[model samples]
Target: MLSADRMRAHLDNARRHLDTARSHTGRVATATGTAAATTGLFTTAVMGESLLATLAATGLGLLVLPTHKARQPEPEKVIERTADGGMLVYTPPAPPSHQGRTAAVLYATPGVGLVGVLIAEWIVPGFHWGEALAVALWSAGTWLLRPARRARHMLVPPLPPVEKVHDLVVQDEPQLYAHPAAQWWAERVAIEGGAAPATVLEDVEKTGESAMRAIIRASIPGEPVPDISVRRLSALMDVPQDLITVGPVPGRGASVQLLTVGQADAAALDPARLWAERIAPLAMPGATITAINLGSMNLSKEDA
Candidate 1:
């Protein structure tokens, strides 16, 4: 039996899948129309060719066109709670690369036949029934040869033994934040930064106060307190005015970290608020937001 939360999550995932399918259907419809138009033009240009011959040529083209093999159905993987109170998800390894080689060889037969026919017409003195039969046999033989060629190349090549290392190198790097919360925050900030500075500046001046006030007023269910900064907190909570600081809490960790502090009007804040509302549900659960600091740190290194 599935938990209520798990069932709801599954339904949400289904809805997302349906939306994606609708989007794809629209694209497929456009592609089909374009392909029909192109084919009609091609038919007009080749008006003298017999319909049967044209179809044969098209069939041969389809067979010869280089395409990756039909993808194998992935094994169904189930996620379940383990005895250790952790989630366990089964992930299957990828299918072997050469699994479809035989199928590819079989499909190449018509292309080989078309080539053989062309060759016979050029080489033979006259187009005759015997010549046609010879071409057909040659084509079949060519198609059968492909699988043998693939098999011959299947042996794994031996690797060279490694020699002693000449140099040792070590570099210290900051550990990157991999959590979805960090990624979402970074992406949101990047998008906001990409907007016209003049427009953002205007917004910073106009709606900054109202947005900040709104953030403080909005109720978030899980947070310990309304702890937030003017910049990030405002953005997260959809507050307009740029947040400068907050009332100090007893423990330093209890207070929200201030990410930014700057002048922002209520107007500029509206867009950020709208963006926050759009992405809030998708953010990592239990993640806290800080204000955006627009100090020297926010400036590009090149500009600095």
Candidate 2:
């Protein structure tokens, strides 16, 4: 079976290849269109028409040259091993998007065509159909080469006003944030588990195939967060107490983080043994252990 790292590597390589192919394809289209237009210009019998067509084709070629857009690198977060033999997964918030810049480019692209038309008129005194056609083709090619913006819909749309919601809407997918379980779990923990009233789920960080880290925050102003025990957290998370570790988030006073190993790991460890061996070491060393792929740590009785 292929590992997650290998799969990610393969996907990245494929994306690079696709980007190269897209660049080549755009260049080829521009070259072919410009060449065909130029050839027709020379073949025309009328001297005046041929001159106009030749000038138009030259202008089209210059305008149609592919523009390279520099891609921004994505921000990456890491799970670091703290000196106290614990893992701290810190994921910074995503940066603002470049949609505004993209919109500006979209709006400015048509100006290139306008500029071509103005230059063509300067070269050939009167307005000609040949120049108009070249401008239109250049504009079309520019729009076609660029990727179109897609309209996005929320996976779970916001609730309407209290009077409008006649029916109940349920969200699924317990393991991830794309559904209701993550939010529900946090709310339940806050409301029923006697955490803070303003507590909310910050993020769900997956450590490996065998474990995940859930970050919950209590948002009461000017008040210190109450200590939440592992027993209560385990009950809220629906896992064995031994499989869960509750810790305070450094620098974030009202926030707490919980690490929960999978049930398979539970069978391998005698209550709390898994934490000392796999995760606790991260806290004790103080060194950042960046690469961790704990794939199914189900061992036999002798191995345990």
Which candidate gets the maximum lDDT versus the true structure? Answer: 2
Local accuracy of candidate 2 as per-residue lDDT tens digits, 43-100? 3234345345545644553343232232334778879999999999987765644643
Give model 2's clash tally.
9
Candidate 1 regions off by >4 Å? 1-127, 147-187, 191-237, 240-304
- Per-residue lDDT of model 1, residues 75-105, tens digit only: 6787999998999999777565454554455
What TM-score, to 2 decimals, does candidate 1 have?
0.19
TM-score result, candidate 2: 0.26
Candidate 2: stretches off by over 4 Å: 1-181, 192-197, 254-304
| Candidates' C-alpha lDDT | 0.41, 0.52
Clashes of each: 30, 9
